[model samples]
Target: MSDQELFYLLALLKVDGVGDIMAKKLLTHCGNAESVFKAKLNQIAAIDGVGSSLLKKIHDKSIFEKANEELEFIKSNNINVSFFQDENYPDRLKHCIDSPVLIFSSGNINLKNRKLISIVGTRQITSYGSEFCKKLIEDLVPLDPVIVSGFAYGVDIAAHQFAVENNLQTIGVLAHGLNQIYPKMHKKYVAKMEENGGFMTEFWSTSSPDKENFVRRNRIVAGMTEATIVIESADKGGSLITANLANDYNRDVFAVPGRVTDKYSQGCNNLIKTQKANVLTSAADLIYILNWDVESKSKAVQKQLFVELEPEEQKVYDFLLKNGKEILDFIALQCDFPIYKISGILLNMELKGVIRPLPGKLFEAI
Candidate 1:
């Protein structure tokens, strides 16, 4: 479709109560956004949800003029827009019941990746959550999967940062419009992400970051990815909404196990116990659950044995290898080393491919 037509479709979406299903019905009857724009009051009133009241309001010339003005503003801002029927629209999200009719983007987006995993968790992530997110990203890096997450604090930030560091593409599905980044503190990381990956939203540039918008935003994250991973969430956290949405969308849901006594872990543990999400202890768990077929991942593991490491690094690696995965605190205790020193050694070992980090601040030998 032409740019003007696409803009008109997006404009229609901004109308109150004209959601995806209703808009689609109107489009089916009228043929396209242009046709809908040109429809008479009576013609519009024939469609579902288009009552005489809505039809009269839609027929007002002032509304169309305002829409046109908004279109002009969007054009002036150089924001990238996509309609539901466009070829570039993300296929994974297209089939969702509440899929947006238009999406505004401000970064490089590759929607064709076969493997997309979303990592979401509490904004107030503990050290355990951060470590879990870091290791999961590192393991998924070699598989060349596209990482998706919100650009919020905690697990979201860690996921995006690790993806960038590992040279993998990451997409931040924002709750607000592309006109600005939320949590303004993450502006630098958002800028860096635009250079490497991209940002996406259904809201217009003038749209505010309202509370309801975030609940709506989680659907996009859940719909666009092949799987959703909840790193660490409280019993009532928003990450649970995303996981439930993923399940509704027929996408895999994985939850990293956390201590039962910890408040932050209650959601994840509940999900696993209730069979709402698979118990994910490592990246390998995710790979298997999704049935990802990257032979290279296995080859990368087998390429070298006895990976070179410093004595301290080797100690950490040997300990993890022998004991399976262990949390940082536990590893430190086992190795009789200071927590700070053990952290440095583990990071070096991770870089040297001597071990792999798991979600929830755990590490295991490759």
Candidate 2:
């Protein structure tokens, strides 16, 4: 599509009473976005949701001029626009019921990766949730999965941080446009992501991050992945909305279990009990369900270790391998080193890619 056509399509998305479904119908009836803008009142009204009043409002030339101004504003910001028919549009989200007619993006737009997974959970996360997210990313990094999240606090931030630390690609789906990052504190992280991954949104640059927009954003998160995994959620958390949308999209849903008494875990346990989501026990379960080739991943892990580790780091590694997995306290005791010294050694070992730390203050030979 030409730049002018993309501008018109984005303008249609900003119109009142025009949603994805209706916009799609209008686009089908009229050949392209330019044709839709020039269509007669009766022609537009013939579509299902278009009424006489709506058609008259859409027919006003002033509205088209405002849309033109909006397009000019978008151009001034250097943002790229992708319509539904564009080859770079995400195919996974295209099949959804309310797929956006236009998407505004910055940075990479590759969605053909088969091992995409969406990690969603409560904004108010617990210590358990944070540890789970860290370990899960560490395991999946070896398999080279593309992590997707909302880039919100708690679980979302943890997921993105882990992905970056492990040098994996990740994508953040925003409720608002790319003009500003919500919560503002995440600006640095978002900038880093643009270099390594990308940011995507359905709304234009002027769209504000309103509460209602989040409900719309949740559908894209679910639609864009092969599976949705909820780490921790309350009974009525927004994570459940993504899981429900995943079910509607016929994508697999998985939930990590927590203590039944913990309020944060109630939603996940309930989802599993009601058969809405499968219970997730480990990273291996997700790999198996996705039918990824683990043997090749294992080989890659070995190669990474050989190339990344140094001689002194190999000494710490041999110690961990001889004793198997152990707690930091146990390792300190065995090595007869002070706690601070042991910590420094362990950190250096981790930096060299010699070993991995598991949840619950344990370390394991990688």
TM per prediction = 0.81, 0.80
Cα-based lDDT at residue 165, candidate 1:
91
Candidate 1 error regions (>4 Å): 296-366
* Full-model lDDT, candidate 1: 0.80
Spell out the clash pairs found in candidate 1.
Answer: 132-359, 132-360
Q: Which candidate number would show the highest TM-score if scored against the true structure?
A: 1
Tens-place lDDT per residue, model 1, 1-366, is 666786677667656667888888888899987788788777888776777666655555655666776687678887778788788887889989789888888777776644788999998899888887887777676568888898888889888999999888889988987778898999989767877778889887677889899989999999988899999999998899999999999999999888999999999999999999998766656765576654444445553655667888777777887899898779989999865466556655655666666666677887
Residue-wise C-alpha lDDT for candidate 2, range 309-347, written one tens digit per residue:
555456566778998998877787776765444555565
Clashing pairs in 2: none
lDDT minimum window of 10 residues, candidate 2: 297-306
- TM-score, predicted candidate 2 vs. hidden true structure: 0.80
Find the candidate with the highest lDDT and give its number.
1
Go through the candidates in order and give the C-alpha RMSD of each one to the true structure.
5.6, 6.8
